[model samples]
Target chain A: MSAASLPAGEPRAIPTAFAIAEALRIAMASDPDVILMGEDVAGGGLRPEGTEEIGGIMSVTRGLVGQFPDRVLDTPISEMGILGAAVGAAVTGLRPVIELMFIDFLGTCLDPLLNQASKFRYMFGGKARVPLTVRTVTGAGLQAAAQHSQSLYWMTAGIPGLKTVIPSNAADAKGLLLAAIRCDDPVVFCEPKGILFVASDVPEGDYEVPIGRAKVVRRGSDVSLVGMGATVGMALAAAADLERDGVSAEVLDLRSLAPLDEDAILETLGRTGRLVVVDEATPRCSIASDVAALCVDRGFDLLNAPVRRVTAAMCPVPFTRVLEEAYMPSPARIVEAARALL
Target chain B: MTRPPTTEVLQVAYRTMRTIRSFEEALVALVTQGRLGGFLHTYVGQEAIAAAVCAHLGEHDHVASTHRGHGHCIAKGVDVRGMMAELFGRRTGTCGGRGGSMHIADLGKGMLGANGIVGAGIPLATGAALTAKLKRTGGVAVAFFGDGASNQGAFHESLNMAANWSLPAVYVCENNGWGEFTPTAFVVPVKDIAERARAYAMHALIADGMDFFDVYAQAGEAIARARGGAGPSLLECKTYRFLGHYVGDPLVYRAKHEADDWIRHRDPLRLFEARVTREGLLTESNLRAIDVDVAALVADAVARAQDAPFPDAGELLHGVFATSDAEGAR
Candidate 1:
């Protein structure tokens, strides 16, 4: 069923991140196994009281602390500690959703994700399960600078044990977060910072979008524009502009990055001879490059033209708004890149 | 004044120490001979810490070990034959031989793998303790790290979390005076790592790691407190490693006298022998019989490991995914 045919959507105009936080809260409320641990979750520990909210700077986890007082936790500014606790809790019985805060902070706490949690089940001879989700904010937008803004889902996707998922919209964010929390594998749920405040029609009832699935947002025949996270919005906008120009653009929203939907990607590419990848991440050795490589490796003969890429320049996400805007993938850039391939 | 351990506990501790010593020496020889192919961090000097701490633990209690973890593995009841086979890169081993010296794991006995990365095990132990707490299993999780790991950010973070949550965990830092080649004096400026626990409001204890009784007494108290929901504790065991950082280091960086003296005069195995024999808890003859039995076990493991076949080419991709059929087969 299409969006127009569906019944009236929920009245609440919730931001994507808040919707995801609500889903986690609902899961925590329903299941005692669900717990949340992150930095400054119960704020004002070190500082004077009444300074900030329970959750950290995002305020996405605002009321979770009061709702699930024992389960909702504020950890030290230690990603490793948070991730490790999640791993242990998962192995025993608790399903923990840990916020990494920023994907850039992975440098400090990657071992728990990579070495420990990732390898636990396999190393334990298939005896253990780490049903853990690490929620981190990503993408270069809002001028958060290099350290805060990075779409590092591609990096996590490269790791074997992790299931890296990047939700492009509010519904996907809520559904994917719920699915990731319930999955028996370690999932890196990256929330694009730009999309957090973006409003969307999310259902009221509990729903989950299966992991390792891609959504075909727009149907077309000319060229396929594959994108993830914030770039998906860019691709859709670019598709609208492309449609006016008589170029029917098929927009593929790659909801999950790790167990990449090679079938959906190849099928889209097969039907549409031209392909363009729009990723907010850096150009060289990125998701853009990876998707292009996959197309060449599998659907090489199907392509009518060389795969085009609209990605950030190979540099750090600058602090200035102009530079950050230049660094992020824009709808204009996606349109320009897709037109070139066409 | 420390009380003498029972005959059974003394035998077990002595067995653990003796097995660790022999296993490290054997692994060292194997590495030199090119039988084992990975980096080998031996638990030679820090035997008492593993022996005594594990004396209070059973299969229910869990432990997360560092790279220097053969002693911990044996003490925690991992099959010696499986560990040896894994070191030899045979598929019959624990972890299906995928984990070599640094990654040897036995989850059945609650020995979480020996981690290659320093301070990585601290948080894992904290997590295991959390799992135990949630399960209400009354099982304590122990983290055996080094003085080097004590300085890592994870070490501090995990200690605070464990203390705050009242997780049943005991953080043991085997202060062997060195981390890899760098001595603790160069890496850490503090007089004692245990003193940092006061910041987290956790009880802290320091013990002579070379003395089995010292480690045993302190570990017993801390473990007891954890089970009783008192909170987490930091137990810093002043220990030493007889061998170099890896198997082949010249060890010229360390003051020769310090290591030499510890090995010769302050050997935990020798000290334990003296104490147990002096107290008449066990005779020298009884210890000799156990040593002989252990030697045979170690020899058999090595022999079997030598004869064991390496995993086939097709087996490389296996175990990466826990398939439904495979999970059911187990």
Candidate 2:
């Protein structure tokens, strides 16, 4: 319910992926119990010269193995084993931050998250504690295609025991990842692949953006533009373009999905009677649909117009850059959706 | 012919086997009387494997169990009363009535719940061992799975990872001849499941699953190897399940004669009793006293379980997440 305080350290420009890597480095240095494991997380598995390989697919865990070689392990290409073992390690008192490579790979290893980590504390009657953090890449802008380019945070967010969070920028990526790693429950940390290379001013040193709290990045009184992950950037872009049309738009970034900041959503809707949800995921049963339903359920009286959602079409992400861009919910679509509501 | 176990260890093994037998028998009766709900898989004929393997473990050691996990739970020194209450769906159960027969878990005892999914516990145990290795806890993790699970991808992946990482883990496969309704031989081309461990470059051992001494000796070596940081090993115990897959199944897959043959000739309890008494490691009177004690213990557990009240409706929403207020909001 409380918002994470902004970091007090001097700000420096860094990529979101580098910010995540720094956060992991801080967590490992802070706590001996914190360990990192995933496929090629450390890289350089069989290199004869033993040079550092790709720190991670996106280099989010780069240079971590050099400092904490024992803690940061390179796992085989087995998502099930990696996740299941992470759950086991978490229950046994070690905090494990595992990489799922991509959110779509969740299909291969759903049992550990759905049946094991998510259900352990409940199924064991409050006797178990799974302090496991699953960090995975999501979003559809890279033309990585169907399997790799998917914003499937809603799946984990919908589960009962799991905590799902997506950071919209570099600062939030570092802070929220720290929070997720330190939190006592299982958290699905979704990093937007679209923003992996995007650079922004981020604070150095340790700080945590509390999970389940949304940040009102830009405030206005006419229409509310709500989004998360990469879509939040699109929402902001749309809000800026809407200013030319004499429309004052408020931008709200939902940092956490599972704890769905109902109060924030309602407060934003109360201030602005019009609402538009932008999500990179498919329309059906997605966060866009979820927020739209939330507005209709709790903030219906506050709305002056019907809530609208601008989401990607319900189809596999095409490989062509142009088609992929078209498939993704763009700022134009968000502007159109917001205009429709107004 | 490993050295005979001490008299005290033999008595402990006998009590474990006896407790498992009495517990499963009580469950069968409870299910037959329609008192217990959900699927019930009994570990009647494979008592020796759990008892002997668990005897080598301590409170610091971890074990992940299969669906037919009653024997594993008892062998690991889980509170029989709590397990029985869990089966009865009472608030006082191990999982506070959340986990039934298939999912009973007591983490305080280092038993990482009985999993419902096939081959799910392998990676869990491997991970526990990884934790131990990372933390330098010197604790070894054991996974008790069936012959059917060995064919699952999880089994291979877990074994390969454990071997690659040299994790402190031991995988024990109870080759009970059948995988649910189907014969394991029909599905698995291999004659011995342990032979598959060669792919991972790990040592594979076999034991008489029906003999307490054999299983104890083999499990001891494997568990010791894991604890000593010799990496992972697979121990396959040739055994049988006397009961059908679940309580309600008619068991039409196997001929009645085949079931009768395994039940009569290869019963683990019978083999243990005969061997211990003949070897003078344990007297017949000693085993009979254990049997009586176990029977009384099981009866008391059932009585207490039946009397325990069910969890209130409010409990339905609790315990999902450890720290989030969202669980309470839900």
Candidate 3:
């Protein structure tokens, strides 16, 4: 959904970060079973009442503790413990929405995600239901350096039993977050750090953007730009640039990665014979590659030219502004890739 | 002062210990005969720790276990037949053959899987305790890990979180002095693993893993503290592993007499029987009768496991994820 530049004062309009907090509040209010935990989720631990909550490094969970004092928790700076405990809590009857601060930190606590939470239902003869939602920040562009800015959604999506979703806008952010909390399986809800400040209209109260469904945010015919999370915005910007050049570029926001909307990918390729996949992550084994491969394998007949991919450099996210800009996929890069496909 | 266990509790404890012992011993035959295929970390000597600690846990209380997990599964009320089928990798196994020996679980009985990763289960139980405390379920969570797991970062992180939150959890370290092939002493810096709890400011206790009465008593207080909302506890049971690590593992890691001494003098099952029979809480005939019943039960489980078929090729795709999504937040 292409959210217009609505006035911030407008009703129902909220930033992606505020939308996340709103979704958490709605979830906790409706289901007492739903709780949130992470490092600094409820900041100022062990303090008297009225202390300001940091709501994690990005402040997506800010003001949550004051709202849901008992449910919103501040965990130790331990990713493994946070995730493992969340897994245990989820299977045992609590819907936990945990913040991982940054997706780059997943490597420190992947065992709980890879071995325990993801595999529990399947491994336990379908007896265990891990209703867990891991909300973490992703993508580069903030100059957060390689350590904090890597797009690791590819790793979680590649896993057998994980549901990975990345919303392109604040509305989907609220909807997807709610759906994740309700899902019986473990969901990695990736929030692209680049778009956290972007304002969009979000529906008040509860609504779920179904998992595993992609949204065609901007539709056209000549070419399709495939992207998820932050890359979708770049694709939209690229589509705008392509439109000026009279190249009708369709933007397919691939919100869900694991149970990938293969139908949408093939359908987009059918309408627009040329395709360009834009990704913030590196190209090797990335979602961009996956989509490109999917098109060749399943939509080979639909292709007019070879599928083109615009992705970050294979090297780490550079610390310098100019180098990092070159490292990440930009609208210009996406437009250039789409031109090649056309 | 804590009172001794009742005759009924002792009988229940004996039955659980006997079931675990018989189950592992029966697997020894199956593994030796080449009926079971996967790595089998037998809970041969660590029976008392699982049996006694799990005796205090009910259906609502959760227990996360280590690779040597059958005993924890049994003590926590997982079906022996399903567990046997799991070892056999049959469709009827606890995991529907998706998980082999290292990952059998029954959430209905609060038996979280036998984790393949050494320190993985610590946070799970700690999280379960978080659920118990927040939901006011009056339930406690137990993590039964090896001495080796005490050194894992997950262990330290989980304990620190559990103590900070005052979660209703009991950390049961089955200190069999071996983490995989290496001795626990060679790896862990601390002598009593319970000393690790001090860093978290948690209550700590230790017990001779071979003595069921000692384990049961110490575990009782820990579980009580957890259930009473007083907070978490670390109960380190000084135990031994009869089997090397897995079935068919050569006994070359340590001297043969080390296994022999623990088996002869500190055997949990033998100790239970001797103590009960000597105290007249139970007679030899009564113990023998229980053993016969256990043997029959084990024999039936093995027969059923072997008779069960392997999962269908199509079954490979099942249970990977929730087939569909739920509406709204729950």
Candidate 4:
């Protein structure tokens, strides 16, 4: 609630991808336990003619392989192997950050993540501490199509033992990611492919925004707009566009999906009395649905209307630009959903 | 790369195999008599691998296990009573019975877990080895997986990473010839799972899994090489399961003769005892004395297990997150 009344600025420039890479580098430098591993992370292990880059799949980890040669590993194209190794390393003493490259590739390595790391401490009766972070690119906009573009945070967030965090902006991305790496739990940090190049002001130094907390980006007293990852940007845009129509919309950035900031959602709903959840994932059993259910269960009396959800339709994300556009939640859709609630 | 283990090590090897065989036999009886709850994955046929491999390991060395893991846990120095109590689902059990047969673990002994997930322990073992290398603990980690788990992604990734980094790890694929109900031939391609090690640039060795001496000799060299920073090795112990996949599994998928034949002739403990007695290195009286002591140990463990209570209901929420509740939920 105190997030409001803070200073506002012109939102300086810091690429979300760079912020992530820089934050990881800082964490790795500070803690020797932190290590990076992924495919093509070292950019084919070749530095041809002034190209001293790791050539990360998304370039989010472009400079790390050069910084920490032994620590920054370029693994084979095996998601299960990469994730499993990260789990192993985390349990043994080192905190490993493995790149899934793309979230869709999770089909190959979900067991180590879902069954093993998530249940280790619980199954072992809390004797284990799996301090591992799996970073993967998610969402559309790259024309990489369905295989590369998916908002699958709902699956990881639903699992009890894992903590899922997705940051919407550069600052939050750096802060939340640092926190995730430091936290003594397995976390799936999904970076939206759509927002990689998008920029915001990041505090150039190491800082960790605690996991399991929410940040209210835009404040208004009418309807609350809840969104995460790339959709958070769209929701904020929709909120800005809605202000001209005299519709007061409070934009809530649902950063940490699992450890849902129930207090923030309840407090905002208690004041706004209306809700609109926007997600890039399919409608059936998504983060949107989870948030809506949470509101109904806890903030039922505070609602002025049935919670509105603007999410990707229940179908495979199409490859075509027009179809993909229709498949994902748009800024206009967020505005319309919130306007309807108002 | 080096000479085989001496006669003294061989005798220790025989003792380990005999202990594992008797412990599993005792557990099988307990399960049939309703003394144990849940399912049991007996390491009945794979005694040589655990005995031979664990003999070379010390307190600093680590080992990760599979679901069929009671033998490794015991061989690695986990209290027999704690393991038995865990199998009985008692509060005083190793994991408070929260983790049954598939999840027995003793962190103090550096036994990560007997993972239910196939091939999952491979990467965890590599990771432990990485920690050892970085911390300069002068130790290595071993992952004992079944032939069925050899084809898994964790196996490949861990092997590649360990070889590339030259981490001190030994991935011993206990080729007991079956994974659950399916035979290894039905799942794996090659007759020797160790041959796959070449793909990752790791050294591979094949050993007689039914003979404790062979297992101990080969595994000892592999472990020494790894601890000396020569990198990971794949030791495929060719063995056969003396019992069904789990307790009470009817050997309907395979011929019952295979299990019968292995128990009668290829049994690791029997083979170990015969070799020791024939060599005149250890007497039958010494083995008989060990048998009596092991029987008492197992019986005492069972008695303590029956007396141990179930975990408190309120403690269910504890241990999921490492931090204090006020810090953050895991």
Retained native contacts per candidate, as fractions?
0.53, 0.79, 0.80, 0.64
Give the clashing residue pairs of candidate 2, or none: none
Report the first chain's TM-score for all candidates. 0.93, 0.96, 0.95, 0.94
Off by over 4 Å in 3: A1-11, A46-51, B325-330
lDDT of each residue in B1-330, candidate 3, tens digit only: 246888888888888999998999898998788877888899998888888887787899999998889899999998999889888889888888878888988888888889999999999999899999999999999999988899899999999999988999999999988888998888878889999999999999999999999998999999998888899999999989898899999978899888899888999888888888888999898888889999999999999988999998766667777654331111
Of models 1 and 2, which has the larger TM-score?
2
Per-residue alpha-carbon lDDT of candidate 4 for residues A1-342, written as tens digits (9 for 90 to 100): 111112335444668887887778789899988888789876666567875564577777776676787787777787776787777778878898888888898888898888788888877867889899988889987778878888888899888788899999889888999999998988899899878888788776778988888889999999999989998889988988989898888989989998788888888898899999989899888889888998999899999998999999888878998998888899999998888876
- Ranking of all candidate structures by their TM-score, best first: 2, 3, 4, 1
* Candidate 4 pairs with clashing backbones: A43-A54
lDDT of each model, Cα atoms only? 0.84, 0.89, 0.88, 0.84
DockQ of 3: 0.60
lDDT of 3 at B292: 95
Whichever of 1 and 2 has more DockQ, that candidate is 2
- The residue-by-residue lDDT of candidate 1 on B1-330, one tens digit each, is 234578888888898889988888888888888867778888887889999999989888989998888889999999999899988878778776777888887777888779888998898889889878876889999999999898888898999889988999999989998888887888676899998999899999999999999999999999989988998999999988888898888888888888889899999989988988898888999899989988899899999998988877665445543322222111
DockQ of 2: 0.78
What digit string (tens of lDDT, one per residue) describes model 3 on residues A158-215? Answer: 8878889999899999999999899888999999988898988887667999988998
Worst 10 residues of 4 chain B by lDDT: B321-330
lDDT of 2 by residue, A1-342 (tens): 001123446787778888888888889899999999998888775766845567778777777777897888888889988998898899898999999899999999999998889888888898788999999999888779999998998899888899999999999999999999998899999999878889899987899998889999999889999999998999999999999999999999999998788899989999999999998899898988989999999888998999998999899999998999889999999999888887
Model 3 has how many clashing residue pairs?
Answer: 0
Computed on C-alpha atoms, the DockQ of candidate 1 is 0.45
lDDT of 4 by residue, B1-330 (tens): 555667677766666666777778888888788776687888888888898899899977889999899989988988889888888888888888778889988877889999888888888898788888876789899999999888877788788888987989999988988889888999887879999999988999999998878887899889999999899999999998878789888889988778888888888888878877898868899888877888888888888998989888767677766754432342
